[model samples]
Target: MIKTTFSIKDLENLSGIKAHTIRIWEKRYSLFTPERTDSNIRRYDTNALQRILNVSYLNNNGNKISAIAAMDDCQLEAEVKKHAEKGNTTNHSLQEIKLAMVNFDKNLFNRVFNTGLKELGFQGVFREILIPFLIELGHLWHSNTINVAHEHFISHLIKQKLLSHMEHVDYQPDEQHKELYILFLPQNEMHDLGLLFLNYELLSRGRETLYLGTYMTLEALEHFQNKGKKLVYITYITVDPTIKKVPKFLKQFEKNVNKNGNSDLWILGQMVAKMKDLKLNPTHKTFDSIEQLINGLETSKKLEH
Candidate 1:
């Protein structure tokens, strides 16, 4: 279900403004006039949420709270647009993306995305902007600030961007590349935007990749092993294989997919935190962040040369 009302805490999580500061702004500048329930708890609607996000953006970018509060709705929005266009700062783009996700505004998302693409190019946009946005989106999801629909909506848009950009990549893997990168999501794990980005990264680097998308099982991966090339199996774990089952999953994965040690498993996402104490097999590697994964690959390539 779409969220119609949000609490002050939700605003705090979304806007990166403290609830106390929001309360102060409400009383001092009338920045928001939230409704009060019988229990006196503040409730804000979508319009108010949008305002606070814009206000927060301006405030973070050097506009004073008093100056922001004095502006009318049109003036406030114009200021936001002006500041956003000034540099298309990552924070501004991120705030705009968040607003787009919250309001289900496809046009807004596309505008911000296209602007980033023009200015930063695909790699810069993905690594410098979209990755941070996704990370914050994950936190918002966990904090109960956003619902599943918001995630799916934004993910679909980003997946579209990745696919369209992938189609434009002119690079092709050479016969001497000697490694095949296979990306997938574990069974019951449906989040694939990260995997899609990884595929784009591989393709952009002239690496051969087989993208299996989502809901992949260990048995399905076993088929690609021993193909006379070094197989790099990569997976993004968003919510599958409960923390309790991760050890078993890893064991089964090693036994079924990498039993011959001719392949490697590169694991990423939140699940990696759960495997800290678990003894990984020789062929297993975990990346705490996408930057680390990309950098590690480049570093390894340098070492290999």
Candidate 2:
């Protein structure tokens, strides 16, 4: 009932299967016969998408397409489930997660996440499974292959997990060699999972952090001015400031920083990556990935010592 019909392009985006390869599979192996629209355009149903996702998962895990094509649906489902429970490795769980998203099965999503959490702990679940899973989900969202419901379903699940982790983090700010980090998003920016997770990471490291999550204006951030020994303003900008508005935000942020407070703005997310040359004199730095940003923080912690 959730409009499960998809085009070949949607299948490609959702499954990471090249259209050409799908065509090849159809011709050579009779993969799944797609129904034709009134105009004879190929349209795939929910079952077809699931099959493609299952096939793609197996194919990515070293199963040959020809071999997969020969297997019956029950056999494929059993094998996929076997891999899903095997270990933290393999694309099986991600494939499962995708299917869960399609079905809007909250229980399935929790099961996959719990398995990773049990095996890897919180950070491990984040780095090993959730982050990579997000990268795939991003591709789906970017390609418009997924709807708002799918995106919101997975994001809120992740958000709940992050919040749960934060509740247990002991907020111990090291007295010596300590910096107060004010984490925020620019005005109109509503994405906060990345920023919240960062706050979690910093808090876990015993760093003092003030998380002003989402939709923070430059004017409001000025209040955190000069809050500690060393001040660092960190933010993940996913939306709100466009490629054009980014430079303007940089200028405004610099002015908004505690005057000569010797603060540095550490920026992350796509806007910075896209606008790599956007500079902030000596007041700002851009990180390409979360790992890079974490490494930078670790190095900063060492230097502060």
Candidate 3:
């Protein structure tokens, strides 16, 4: 059996409820019956944590604790589900997901993701919801609304989903077009889900890719360029290669890859869009959105063939 025990801190972090309030609920309404550790510490199980979250959600929306505590399991779950599904423009669903992540609630995250995917297909969920959600989460983290552990939990879950989709795609190289695109993030740039998903999108459309994952060095890339392999280097400029270093980095990249006759560099990201100093060469391009980049690639491919 999976042990569902959680420390007091875990409960607080997960539900956004104070430890004192939780204790009061436990004493006043018999809200949770957490098992005591051998040394007399309170340890909450998964069910208890879930219940507290449900109660907290209701309480936040003006439900009284006395009434919420009287609710049966089925009733509480139904209420939570209703709230989740209701088209409330003011609802902070992403914040709820963040709370779930803080508590390490894999089930909650999966439920939310799957629901969003069902309502809006993978592309829609990715573009409309997940992307915006990630950006907002980053803001929350930087503003001290959430911590690193919470951010990491959600990031890992999203990465797993992206990797699973990537694995399912086919990536056969076309002899007629023996070009291979390699995608990666530079050193200290750990955000790669967008790049990974783009790789999957390209692979699904019968394009070849050599995904280098996160934190690749410039030196390592130089060794991978082969004569027949028309190289296209793609990266998202989220972090590292800062605004100050972008001009130098692009200069070095051009110098390194210009030796290969047929090589191009494409960049997409918030930082890339904001870059004004870097003068892009004929073989270099920057796109504001993934769709724009893909469209450009398709146009380029048609022109080349």
Among the numbered candidates, top TM-score falls to: 2
RMSD of each: 2.1, 2.0, 7.1
* Better by lDDT, candidate 2 or 1: 1
In terms of lDDT, which candidate is strongest? 1
Pairing residues by index, what is the TM-score of model 1?
A: 0.91
How well is each residue in 65-92 modelled by candidate 1, as lDDT tens digits?
A: 9999999888988998888778847888
Residue 206 lDDT, candidate 1, scale 0-100: 79
Residue pairs clashing in model 3 are none
Note the Cα lDDT for every prediction shown: 0.87, 0.82, 0.75
The regions of model 1 sitting more than 4 angstroms off are 1-4
Per-residue CA lDDT of model 3 for 34-93, tens digit only, reads 889889999877677667778877778778899999998789978877776675312335
For model 2, residues 1-305, the per-residue Cα lDDT tens digits are 36578999888987889998898899899998999999998899988988998899888877889899998888888877776666625376677788788778889989888887777788878877777788788788888888888888889988999999899987776666467888998878776777888889888878888888887888887776656567888988776688888888888877877566578888888777687765566778888777788887688778977
Cα deviation in Å at residue 45, candidate 1? 2.8
Report the candidate with higher lDDT, 2 versus 3.
2
Q: In terms of TM-score, which candidate is stronger, 1 or 3?
A: 1
TM-score of 2: 0.92
Q: What is the TM-score of each candidate against the true structure?
A: 0.91, 0.92, 0.67
